[model samples]
Target: MYAIVEIAGHQFKVEKDQKVFVNRLATEEGKKVSFDNVLLIGDGDNVTLGAPAIDGAQVSAKVLKHLKGDKVIVFKKKRRKGYRVKNGHRQALSEIVIEGITASGAKKAAPKKETKKAEPKAEAKPAAKKAAPAKKATAKADDLKKIEGIGPKIASTLVEAGIATFADLAKAKPEAISEIIAGVRGNHVTDTWPKQAKLAAEGKWDELKKWQDELDGGKA
Candidate 1:
C-alpha cells in the first residue's frame, strides 16, 4: 500500500520502509513523527481519497538524521551601474523513513483552554463636573500609495506596521522604514518618503507633485 502525504509544506508519495528527505523539521534524530494530512491511499484496485484530508488517517515515520542539501549560488548585477552581488545558500533537510500507514486511528490533538486572571476593583471616588461631549469616532486612513515608490503591497505593509497616515509616515525614521519593508521585493530607496509624506499631510499637492517629478522612485 502507498499513501500521499504532506510533510513540511511539501507532498510526497510514500510507502512502508521508504526513506525520504524533506525540509528541516523540529523533530530530533531517532524520534518518531506522524503526519495527519493524508491526501490519498491506495491498495490494489481500491482507493480512498480525502475531501481535503481524510479524518483520522495518518502516516507515521521515524527521523533518521538531519543534514544540509547542496549549495546554491545567487548572483545579481546592474548593467552600467557598477553593482554586483553573489551569494550561496544551502537548505536544511531531514531524512526520515516511513514506518506505517493507518487508514483511521490517529486522534486529533485537543485545543488548550485560556484562563483569564481576575483583577482587583478600585475604590469609588467623588463625582466631578462633567466635561464637554467627545467627538464622534471615525476611521480615517491616508492613501500611502500617493507617496512615490510605494505600491499596493508596500502600502499595506506600512499600514500593518502602524504607519497608516501621512503624518505617521512623516514622523517615521528612514532606517525604520527600510527595516519595515526589508522583506519586500526589489530595491527601495526611502530617503524621500518622509519628505513626500510631510508635503502631502500639509496639503501641498502642487509642491509634492513638483518634488516627485524631480525624484526617481522615491530616491533622492
Candidate 2:
C-alpha cells in the first residue's frame, strides 16, 4: 500500500520501509513521529481519497537523521552602478523512513481537561465612575511604499509605529517620522514625505506623480 502524506510544508508519496528526505523537523534522531495529514491511500485496485485530508487517517515514520543540504549561491548587481552582492545558503533537512500507514480508525488523542478552583467574589461598594475617553476607529493600512521616499523596510517601520494610512502619514511630523525610521539603513530625507502623503490622501495622483518626478529620494 502507498499513501500520499504531508510532511513539514511539503507533500510526498510514501510506502512502508521507504526512506524520504524532507525539511528539517524538530524530532530527534531515532524518534518516532506520526502525521495525520494523509491525503490519499491506494492498495491494488482499491483507492481512498480525502476531502483535503482523510479523517481518522495517519502515517507513522521514524526520524533517521538531520543534516544540511547542498549550498546555493545568490548574486546581485546594479547595472551602471558599482554595486554587487554575493551570498550562499544551505537548507536544513531531515531523513525519515515510513513505518506504517492507517487509512482509517486512527482516532486523534483526546485533550486532557484541566480542573480549575473556584474563587470567592469581593463585595461591591457604591462609588461614582469616571467616563472613559472614546477610542478613535482604526483605519485600514495603505501601501506606504507608494510615497517616493518609503521603501519596504521604511514602510514596515512606519506601520509598526502606527503611521499606516496615507492620511495618518499626512498628519505625521517629518522630524518624528525621521526619528521613527532613524535605525533603518540609508540616509532618507523626510522633507517631502508628508506632502506626498497629503497629495495621495487627497486623491491627487497626477499632481503627486508630477511632484515626485521633480524630487530625488523625497528631497525637493
Write model 1 residue lDDT over 70-134, tens digit each, in one string. Answer: 88888999999999998766666779999999997422221211132221111011011111111
lDDT of 2 by residue, 68-89 (tens): 6788877999999998998766
Per-prediction TM-score: 0.48, 0.48
CA displacement after TM-score superposition, residue 210 of candidate 2 (Å)? 49
What lDDT does each candidate get?
A: 0.75, 0.74
Off-target runs (Cα >4 Å) in candidate 1 are 105-220
